[model samples]
Target: MEVEITTEEKILIAARKVFIEKGWDGARMQEIADNAGINKALLHYYFRNKEQLFKRVFAGIVGKLIPNLNTIIQSEQPIFEKIQAFIDAYLDFLLANQELPLFVANELSRNANLIVGAFEENGLKPMVGQMVMEIFQAIENKQIRPINPAHLLMNIVSMCVFPFMGRSIFQKVLMQVPEEMYQELLKQRKKEIYEMVYHSIVL
Candidate 1:
C-alpha cells in the first residue's frame, strides 16, 4: 500500500519547490496547490496565503544552515580549527543548495524584518554571544590578531557566500569552467577560504 502524505507535508513540499524555482514574488498559491495535487482552498486552509507559506518555507531552508554555525561557535576547538571546519561545512552546504542564497537574498530585500524574526524565533542571540566569547578568547590569548568579531564574521560569511551569489555569472560567463571542473574548483575553494581566513587573523 502507498503511504499517505499529510495535507500539510504535501503543501509544504510543493511550496518548497515553487518557492525555490520562482521565489516568493513569483510563486502563486494556485500553482502550489496544483503541484501539491490539491485544490487552492485546501492550500489556503493550511497556509493562509503566500506570505505565510513563504515564511514557513524560508524558515525550513534557513533551519538547515544556521544551527551549524552555532555548533562551530560553541565548540572547544581552536580558532583556526573552527575556521577550517566552518568553511568546510558552510561551503559544502551552499554548493549542495545552489539556489538558496539567491532565494534568501531576494526575500531579505523585501522582508528584512520577517527574516530577522525567523532568526530570533530560532534563538540566534545565544549562538551569537557564544561566538563573540570565542572571538574574545582567541584575541586575549593572542592566537589571532585583534579585530571586531562581528566584522570578521561578516567578512568570512561574505567570502563564503559570494561564489554562490555569483554562481550563474561565474559558471556561465567569467571563468566558464566545465561542470565537473567547476565543482572541483569549489572543493578547492574550501581550503583556499580557510587558509585566507586563518592567515589573516593568526599571529
Candidate 2:
C-alpha cells in the first residue's frame, strides 16, 4: 500500500516531469498544475510563480551532484585509478537520474548565471577549470608523464557518459545493446579503461 503525498510534493514531482520533458523554455505552470491534478491557483498558492517552482525543482536536481568528487579530483591516487573512479561515480550519478545532464545543459543555456550560481552553491568552486593545471604540475614534478590531463579527463567522461547520454542515437544509428547489456559492459569497463588511461599517463 502506498500513502498519498502532500500537494507540495505532488507539485514538485509534476514540475520535475515538465522540466525534464519541455526544458525551462517550454515548461508551463498550467501544465505542471494539470500534471499534479491541481488548479493553477492552487499551484500558485504553493509555489508563488513558475520561476520559483522551477528553482525548487532545479535546486533538487543540482543537489544530486556528488560533492565528494572534489576530494577525488585533488587526490594522490594514481591518476588512472582516479580517472576510473571518477567515470564510475559520474556515470552512476547519471544512471540514477537520466534527465539530469540534459536538464542542466538546457537550463544553463537558458541562464548561464544560474548554472554558475548552482556550481558555486554546490561547493564545486572553480575546481574543474583548475583540475588540469594541478594534474599538469604533477606531471612536471615527475609524478606522471607529460600527457595532457584535461584531454584524458574529457576522454574518460565522454566514453562513460556519452554512451548512455546518446543511448537513443547509438541504438538507432550504431549499436543496439539492451540496457542490461550496456550495464554489464559498464561494469566491466573500469579496469580496462583505467589500464588504458594508466598506460597513457605513466612514465
Off by over 4 Å in 2: 1-6, 74-78, 103-126
TM-score of each predicted structure versus truth: 0.90, 0.77
Per-candidate clash tally: 0, 0
- Per-candidate local distance difference test: 0.82, 0.74
lDDT string, candidate 2, 1-203, tens digits: 99989999999999999988998789999999999999999999999977678777766765555465666777787655666767667766777786676667667778888667645554545257557876787788887788767687787776666655666776556777777776776566666666777777778
What is the C-alpha lDDT profile of model 1 across 1-203, one tens digit per residue? 99998999999899999988987678889999999999999888998878778778777777777788778877889778887887788888888887888878887897788777766775544376677788898899998999999988888889888887887899899998888887887778988888888888888
Question: Global CA lDDT of candidate 2, please?
Answer: 0.74
Candidate 2 at 74: error in angstroms?
A: 5.5
Task: Tally clashing residue pairs in candidate 1.
Answer: 0
Query: Root-mean-square deviation of each candidate, in angstroms?
Result: 2.0, 3.2
